[model samples]
Target: MQEARYTLDDLLTLMQVLRDPQQGCPWDVAQHWDSIVPHTIEEAHEVADAIERRAFDELPGELGDLLFQIVYYAQFGREEGRFDFHDIVHVLTAKMITRHPHVFPDGHLGSRRQGVAAVDVDTSAVGQRWEARKVNERDSRAATSHLDDIPLALPALSRASKLSSRASRAGFDWPDHRGALDKIREELAELEVEIEAGHQENMNAELGDLLFAVVNLARHLEVDPEQALRGTGQRFERRFRHVEDAVRESGHPIEHTDLDTLECHWQEAKRIERGQ
Candidate 1:
């Protein structure tokens, strides 16, 4: 006997069956667009986490979970007579072909053969052209602002970075990284003042300002602030776990550990991590 092989159509069929009124899985059939939003977000984060951890073997499963989220939405849309998976696929395919002028014949950059043969096309120029095309698309939708299309559901750091980038494109940004760094310092000073005044509401606002400034600095430095912060969190967890293990080995309860003792273990953990 041979194992069954399935194609994308098979996957679509499976999704349809799972959402069938009579024979469907109750959980799958009961899910609506809003109900599945959290699962979609979690699946996306899992995909990112797998990539960040360099777990290539786990990537396919994570990607499949993310893809299933799209399929779930597509299924729900079909039931409402809005759109289906094919519509989603078609839009993405068309968008890619339209955006990559250097590769596709219909793109603004002309065909790849003609453009590459004629002269070098810098990646930066390609990126700028892509953004320009997206802006045009937004304009076609009657968008009144450069930030209009940015999703509100994006992580705070990522959204801040994108907002700053859009504003910069609109000529409303700092001239350089130095200016962004200076803004961060100014924001931090304001935060300190708010803290000293013991005004919780003002402190909260000032803290947000400081974080936004830091995100802007990250954008100016061409760093992805979300990824940078995620990496920092992972490192902190690893080091903290090492400190905990050391305390356990020394027969000291973590609750009984003094600040100096914890600091000693933290330094040792850092040294071990650095192979020093």
Candidate 2:
């Protein structure tokens, strides 16, 4: 006897059953669009975390959890008479096929460009075509500002990068990374002025502006500001934990460790990380 693998149909059936009004689990029955949004965001972050941490063994499960968020939304759409999972799949497939004209010459899933390897395609042309299509799509949706389509729920650093990128495309940006670096210095000066003034509200506003300027600099350098910050956070965690462990080995609470001792352990952690 062999074990059976569940298929997409089975998953759809499971979702339908879970949302059944009369017989579904109470918690599943109680969930709605708004209630599930937080879980969707969390699942997305977990998937990113798994990838960033290079946990390939856990990637499948993390990806499945992220997929479940889509399924959950599809079920809600079904109950509200708007759409369902198949509708979502069809729209996505059709839209992608339409966008990728170089790949699908006939504007369809079944059509493919023959005798052309993907590497032979001009990436610059492809990017231009993609952006042109996106602009047309935005026009069809009556988008007024380049920034209008960006989601407010995005993490601030990522959003700042996107906002600046959009502005750059609209001819509002610095000519190069040198200009971006100069903007960071200008913002930092303003921040310092606010700090010296001891105005809490102005300081907060200036600090935000300074961080946004840094994000713009990151964009110019072709780096993701959010991912860079997350990497820094991980390094800080490793160094702090090393300090904690050293204090523990000395039979003292980390809270009671002197600043100089903690600094010594932190430096040691950095030295070890550098393979020194």
Give candidate 1 misplaced runs (Cα > 4 Å).
Answer: 107-120
lDDT of 1 at 162: 92
Candidate 1 lDDT over 1-276, as tens digits, reads: 999988889999999999998999998988899999999999999999999999999999999999999999999889999999999988898888898867776554344545265257688888998999999999999999999989988999999999999999999987889999999899999999999999999999999999999999999888999989998999899999999999999999999999999999999989998999
TM-score of 1: 0.94
Q: RMSD to native for every prediction?
A: 2.3, 1.3
lDDT of 2 by residue, 9-103 (tens): 89888988988988788899999899998998899899999999999999999999988889999999998899999999999988888789999
State TM-scores per candidate.
0.94, 0.96
Note the residue pairs that clash in candidate 1.
none
C-alpha lDDT score of every prediction, in listed order:
0.91, 0.91
